[model samples]
Target: MRMYISPRAPKEVLDYAQAEANDSGRHANHAEGSCFPLSWNLPPGADLGEYEWVLNGFDTKDLPSINLVPVRRDEPWETIDAHLNRFGAEYLLGIMPTLWQLEVRFHAALRRSGIPVMMVPPINLASVPSLFAQFPIHTVLTPLRYLPELRTLLPSRDPHYMTILGPSDAPIECSPGGKVSQEVHLVPGMVALFQCETLAARPTTGFHPSDRFIWEWENDRLYVTDPAARFTRLMLPRHYTMREETCDCGRTLTLTEAV
Candidate 1:
């Protein structure tokens, strides 16, 4: 059968996957790398019915062990909440579909309720009461776009827990007292690596290449312009933005509320 690879797929993504696949003993949740960083497309001109593409580098032979907890689609909140409570997930990681939805659906209520409010991180996963009882979750990580929003939206006048950028193990420095200063700094090596090694690994997918990964920066502070940045297979650019700042508690990155 004929096969074609996506031209957008970065060489480093393939290299990273190959390295992980070859050395299966590495932890699956590495801070510096990701398991699935890009969306590789089948080459054009191949007979759709006659050709098939087999993705390499995902052979889970030596990857870390993880629980694939399945939840019922009909009543996911009930099902997942029970599981998390049973398993004791103190720190929960979640995905926000978009900043607009986050603001429209829950931000106001959340703010009114105050910081440290019991929540399931991604609001859809569980009811507020269930989250408080099942997990010790204090921090909710959103997409890179939401980073600026979170800095402004969440009642984080003080340095709370941790702020992880992209898939790296390094955490960004946040100010104390929750009043996030607009000042920022940038890291050259990480940014270059992300552009060449990570973001380079995927096609624009279904979106226009120009609109593929939305980003913005002012005074070296980063901002996520598009909300879709949360749900894409692209590399998270939070660190890329963080690496360009001077780390001053001065100016803030401009945030445009999604319409």
Candidate 2:
């Protein structure tokens, strides 16, 4: 399994790891390198001083295993037009009839390299209750409420992962939607805390990209803008995507699936 620490330094990280390896060490909830430090994509955190299409490296106090892949904002209309003029075949095959080709480009690249991409969902820890309670379809990610760590799911099945950005010790579980017996409610803290290698899956049946796999959120610490306004004023489709794909409830990612 590939463990990704964060944007921290090597020596500092080593010290943390050494401590975690000790019997009397208090670093037990999660491993030192399992946590991947992430960077913000919205403005403020992302400087508007320059319009360059460049990416930044995430800065973590702990050393990260691999450099994170840069992501893009919503698929602007121009992005979609460019794709239609080029890979029209693949473009048409996409769920949304006029989605930006860049949406699927990340998945396509990762698929070719035989690696599942991880996407961090943008959500505030304080308002998490709203997310799971009124979770939207397609857009509402299927967090393996089984994992005990900080990771959460988003709309796209594009191997993209998101972090609701916050620390929580509360136990959370899933409650299936259906009849009395058909519908199931889950317990707290039952989800697996960490899965070292979840980004390994299949050749992907198709592409599923999104503007906000994470509900376009608020909270400067976790999301880009004010989520309350985004959700309330926006007339977006919950899943947002115009298509769907099959998934394994237990299996984490299709591209990073264990063969």
TM-score of each: 0.22, 0.19
Model 1, 1-259: lDDT tens digits are 1111223445554444445435764222222333333333434564455322222111243144211211111211221232234334345434344221222223222333332333334445434334434655544434343455444543423222222222322333333333111111111001211211111122210010111223333332222211222112232333332222221322222121111
Model 1 poorest 10 in a row by lDDT: 183-192
Best candidate (score: TM-score): 1
Q: Candidate 1: misplaced stretches above 4 Å?
A: 1-90, 98-130, 144-173, 176-259
Per-residue C-alpha lDDT of model 2 across residues 1-259, encoded as one tens digit per residue: 2122122224443344444335443222212232222332444575443222211111233344323333332222222232234323221111111111233543443344343432223234334334434432122122223223323422222221211111222212222221000000011111111211111122211112222222121111111111211111111111111122234324222111111
Q: What is the lDDT for 202 in model 2?
A: 23
**C-alpha lDDT of all candidate models, in order:** 0.29, 0.24
